[model samples]
Target: MRIGLAPEVSAALRTDPGMLREVNEDAALAEYPSYLVADGMGGHEAGDEASRAAIEAFASVIRPGEVSTVRDVGIALEAAREAVGRVAANRVRGAGCTLTGAVLVQHEDQVCWLVLNVGDSRVYLHRGAELHQVTIDHSLRDEMIAGGAHLDALPGRNVITRALGSADTTADSWLLPVEDGSRLLICSDGLTTEVEDQELRAALTMGGQPEAVVEELVQRANEAGGHDNITVVVVDVLSGGAAWHVGVDSASGSLAESANEEDLTITATVPRRAR
Candidate 1:
């Protein structure tokens, strides 16, 4: 089935190794219509490899005019899982990463946001002055809370129960109507762990440009101690078909591509933190 052309979009991505880490085990992409953040687990370079592999897998499938249905996204995510599993096979136990992002899709002639998540990474929507988290965390603490356990009684609150390379690698998906002028934020747990929801809401709502907003969020996370590698991607929709730009930062170099009021085809190597 042919999908409708994606809405005019623009995005910005930023990642940092943070104050406590030598290597950033995080990966991000800001290809219009597809934006994601992967936070890797495991130790040293192994986590970095897993996260990069996962992002590359998704990048391979998120082409313009491709990726129409939920099944299409699932296939891409499964490929990512297998890629991470391959890395895990050669490393010590627990090589994995959290994957969360949103892809723009057309359903019944209506544009929709297809959000996916596995682990604690998240996708949040900023509509007008309100910020709403679109994806739920697949963490032990969240599950316990869902099962009627009190938040105060939870243990291992940061332990993610689902992720790429895990035995259960299925990602939860949500399809929601796309609203004009709405903004989407996909980020690693680093930002959420460091900043409160109210702060995130404030930053998102106080946006001047997408790039500036992303920069502010990353800076705030670092100021909050920079305990872990942080990555953030901000996507904004323009009602009148605005210009589009895709920027990719990788070990080799950074590349910026632009499209004037048309669909953007993003092709680049995923960026990994410098060692």
Candidate 2:
């Protein structure tokens, strides 16, 4: 990211309403241990309320600048689901939201990224010229694609199968070790639908600060016809990294100290089962 190597400056976050939308219904956070984006769906008021409520839950459980545990995130996730459910309960149309992000947590006494996703918002691992999406979309079109149907044959892409405020609040997750110089992108659909992955790849590979890259992404999306609210967060695994890995080498200060996060450290999480 563009932030200096002060360790605490590990990420950059940005959000815009886009050219067509009057009110932005997206929310994001770049707090240490957690970086996420929420795409609120429904009317402007309901959508915005749902997204903000979801983010507030994280802010309540995962203290800023502290390392988080799986239990902490789990609690926050449940709270978020409940908050969104309340929003949906009141709205006639039923409010809901898509949430996707990564949490730095202690699993098995090691630092690991707990990547999670619900609905269609995404988390992508941007390495060099390639952009690898790490989250499985819980949308109708994506479900069809997963079922071996062609993209062109699928229905509208916005019909999400799962979301907060829905019957199922389960979120899919994976545990990943921190890789030095690793760059991750947590964004809403505004960015993906408007700007092609090829364009995103070029911007991510071009060595610039996260701020610049985020601006460019939003700019491209707007230029391409911003159909929805856009939110982007760039999280850098290591600022002044040296083969950083979040496991045994962390005690030697090889990879763990790169983030310089001492408040809450991650433990090992194998088998990838995080409720």
Candidate 2 lDDT at 168 equals 62
| TM-scores vs. true structure, each candidate | 0.82, 0.83
* Reference-based lDDT, each prediction: 0.74, 0.75
Stretches of model 1 off by over 4 angstroms after superposition: 1-5, 42-45, 64-68, 240-275
Sliding window of 10 residues with minimal summed lDDT for model 1? 250-259
Global lDDT for candidate 2?
0.75
Per-residue lDDT of 1-275 in model 2, one digit per residue for the tens? 12222233378898999998898889998988789999997453489989999999867888778667666777777778889988888988888888889987665555667777888988877655556777777888978887899766999878888888776656776666566677888899999988877787788889488888888888989999998899999987654333543332122111232222221222232321111
Count clashing residue pairs per candidate.
Answer: 0, 17
Task: Tell me the deviation in Å of residue 179 in model 2.
Answer: 1.2
